[model samples]
Target: MKERIRWMALHGFISGVSKLGARRGDPQARLIADPWVRENPGAFADECRKRGSLIRCRAAFLTFDHGVAHEVLRSDDFSVLEQGSNLPRPLRWIAKKTDPGLLHPLRPPSLLSVEPPAHTRYRKLVSSVFTPRAVAALRERVEQTAASLLDDLDGHDAAVVDIVDKYCSRLPVTVIGDILGVPDEDRPRILHFGELGAPSLDIGVSWQQYQQVQAAIAGFNGWLAGHLRELRGAPGEDLMSQIIRASEEGPRLNEEELQALAGLVLAAGFETTVNLLGNGIRMLLDAPEHLETLAARPELWPNAVEEILRLESPVQMTARAAVKDVDVAGMRVQKGETVIIHLAGANRDPNVFPDPHRFDIERDNAGKHLSFSGGRHFCLGAALARAEGEVGLRTFFERFPHARLAGSGSRRDTRVLRGWSSLPITLDARDAAMSSSG
Candidate 1:
């Protein structure tokens, strides 16, 4: 354990030196190049376990530059991470000013700075909207969107198409817009605001960006408030309308809760799904055999999506505050200490997953990944995200048949949310036979 700490500290020091533009002999790079890190990530987890229940550090395990403190996120220790003092101080500060009607209610309630009962209450009220039955209803709509988007690329001769921007990113946004009754003309504006609301791991929020985001939040709130008023007078079939009606009954969500719930549904619902689709497609394209295998047997689509979620989880990390000093995964965590749980790391743990680096569509146990998280804080939109992934992949391959990556891919800058900004790929219309087989 002492040697491991020294090794990690040395790696951190090396990373700092490299950042100063002082190139050292390829030691650090060579260390990373060692296959053991990828093939045996469990070694690190095991090392952490041997150290103690929890290791207090001012550094991050995922990246050396980031100051995120690490904590082991296990199903057994979920309660500690959820209600503990692990949430980054900055996020807690944001939670204080956060309008419950926006992002606050979607976060875990009580214990955290978020509203009491409101968060959990609101989540339960609208949970049904994202259930398998509800999300499954969007299949036809999602398929139509994919087909229409792909059809636009029919005449293009480009060998590679940017699936991230062209297909993966667009489908979920459109579908969520339809679910929430956002007007076609207003979808882009709403999407922009949603993107701004994405959680950030940075130490501080830019005042300018914060104000801009607040303005956007105000715009969405105003829109939702007006819609709520209308729903009270004459309810519609949309999820917002349902939420409005649900508020009037027992255990109702207040106006602030309504706004927060709607915004969360709009923001988290689509953003995560878009990344899931983008990452999933990129993974499949990288392994043409996997694509061919799925094309030959569409039954594997569901498991294939699960495998993709495991390999490239959209939500990389979740922050929680420790309510009390507690031991976790072998280290002592002091009260009020912030711990960042790396879902990506846990999902890829070798003990939990065999050959964790390889992308295998047939991996039966892939569903066990913590991509959507676990316990009370688990993603409410898991069903919706999965449905979109399955449908998007099925429709995309059915249409393009022979899509291949066009060039280098770009990723979103946000550390908490892992996704592609752009991924160019080429589609062959002539390979329509591949579509019919599925």
Candidate 2:
């Protein structure tokens, strides 16, 4: 009920503002101008397909067709926008005023927001560090972290606990924090900033939510600036120190760029992993058979993570503006036009995956989903995310095999990201040994 009311209020606010400036007779203007489109993207896509796969909405085109979505994502003629502000004009103006630092034009663009050359440079800088070997090196640490987290939760004798809050949220933050040399005490703050800024990833966000994003950006950058300063004087054995050393030794990033890169890396590293763990666990709890199967054959945890990513992707959609005129799915998309790829919908397209909606851990081609996206923008931390998901899932069920959903879960009301805000569950320590013995 609370989520519904909030959704309705937000929808009304955005619609009211958009209608005030939107041209009534303009079909193209109604594309993303319809605020409700964000809430029911699959339905909106179905409606758009009446015209064509690349039907224009307001000024941008939305692709729900799987093949077209894939083609658009992989095309080099498209580029990310300079600042894809999700807020309507008035709301964005207010946000800019509330925290000007967050919208600083000089602020370094993160990998998600940066176009090539710069994007290429950032990817090259971090790719080698996340190689298979490097990710494997962290496997034991991720397992230990996950076990320690579940241990903390299992220590509580309460009948119900918010698993999202207690376990899912902390594991990724701790793992990423440890990698980045962020102190134990500061991990919580990093998690808070990540949560606060996450909604900004959506194509549209409310004024209040935009304000929260701006504040989060400011707080995050401020913290990064201080941390970078400390790392400069006395180097450590962490990734940040390695980055600082690289910057000093070679063609380097300025201080602001260095901080921006670190913030981006840390945020990306933790954010998606958190959702993967949360969403994967929720799916298992919803399907008790799958939960039992996973418990009995823990080797399937990797496949389970991939399936969860396909069905309920952490990053739901990404947009790109056409750099040159090109024909997309039989429609000519002109330069400067934006193409929105609905990844979640594409993943469910039956044309690509046979019986796409079913949750099957043994699904043969599950990794084919565009959940991590494609082309030059493919997720750099894919290996790390997968490793974290595998370990997190295995440790969670092993510690509390009998855990069951205890209450209704509340999902985060963000369009770009999908995951629960709170998932209440009950578990008993006694069930662990009993289930293991059986």
Candidate 3:
């Protein structure tokens, strides 16, 4: 009852309001309430872009402009508020008192949910985990993992396979699991936990959704607690063990902070990368010209990954709240107001990329994308994700040059997290398979 009451006060209330506004043809409302609108957000983004760089919506200030989004994300004036922290004092107290003690993705202590000092400390400690040298070292492992996954698909021969379930989802989770010292058996559970808790990253979720995600969070939290205990008892050479040693010996992290950091690193390590692989696969298959170009000029794979991230951003939008009264694009956004930055829109802005809708692997400024986000809270796992995406997609295509999408696959249901849920792919025995099999 407490959970439901608190949820109703926040997520439920926003959901109901958005639905009502959707009926009145509000763009922001439809953007939230209408699934179709979100899946095809370019038109909606264009509408917002036409209005201005920043427009006051019924719920928050919105920005589709790349410059504005970049500024807000990098600016110190914005805060990544703890979930429900903006509510009335009494309600916030209720939220705090009723907390189920799960490590939620969008709540305090999670790197994505806290302001500096805490965020800075967490990022600084974990920063070594994905340094360029570390990513380069892990590249070979990612390549081997990708090759092994692609090899497993050989049994299908001429049959159509759901690559998402069979490969895309497996590669990153497995690799990241190794990095985190999670056992092979536990990786699938981690993936399941990620999938279930993914919608937790979004706002205005339904009451049932809130319940389901909370339950998943509970499962994840319990499993993680045990895993951390196991790691401490028998520390491994993996990064998580390093984090444990550092936290204990360095500026000491509390139990919750440690759990939050571990959970975010593990989840963030694979979730978006999975989306990146899935989206990259679909993009490469759809645009064979780019694929052919990449085949000839394999050096373009990294830039191609950037273009994929820009064209089909794994994360569509992010929000930041004003810590003080600020003037944005001539609009006075008072203190405490939130601003939604359409990352996808920014990637496709005409001012930035010429022929923005077209997928051009040769595009010069492809790396300028805000897909991994920007500013102090920029994605910590970006180097790893980039390595995984480049290696995974390149290896998959090189191994199965004859691969094609067998059918139109289903996309992930959440608006914030974007990717194919079921990508039916068919691959014939390509020439590259002969040497490996021989």
lDDT agreement with native, every candidate: 0.62, 0.74, 0.85
lDDT of 2 by residue, 201-310 (tens): 65336667756876787888788888888889887877778777876776577886777778877877877887888888888888989987886878788888888898
- Give lDDT tens digits, candidate 3, residues 1-438: 889877876677778888999888776777789877777877778766888888778868888899999899998889886787666577677777877777788887899998779888999888855568877878888988988887788766546789899999999998889878899989889989888887887778888888878888899999999999999899998888988998888878888898999888877887898899999999999988887898999999999999999988999988889999988878888899889888999998989989888899989999999998899989988888999999999999998888887899999878888888889987863443564487
Name the candidate that leads on lDDT.
3
* Number of backbone collisions per candidate: 32, 4, 0
- Which segments of candidate 2 are over 4 A away from where they belong? 1-52, 84-99, 103-108, 429-438
Estimate, for each residue in 290-406, the C-alpha lDDT of model 1 and write its tens digit.
988988999999999999898887876565545567765445555555555556666766666788768999997999888886656567778778888998888888877777766
Which window of 10 residues has the lowest lDDT sum in candidate 2?
98-107
Q: Which ranges of candidate 3 are over 4 A from the true structure?
A: 87-94, 429-438
Where does model 1 exceed 4 Å of error? Answer: 1-54, 59-116, 128-131, 155-161, 199-219, 429-438
Each model's TM-score?
0.75, 0.86, 0.95
Residue 283 in candidate 2, Cα distance off native in Å: 0.7
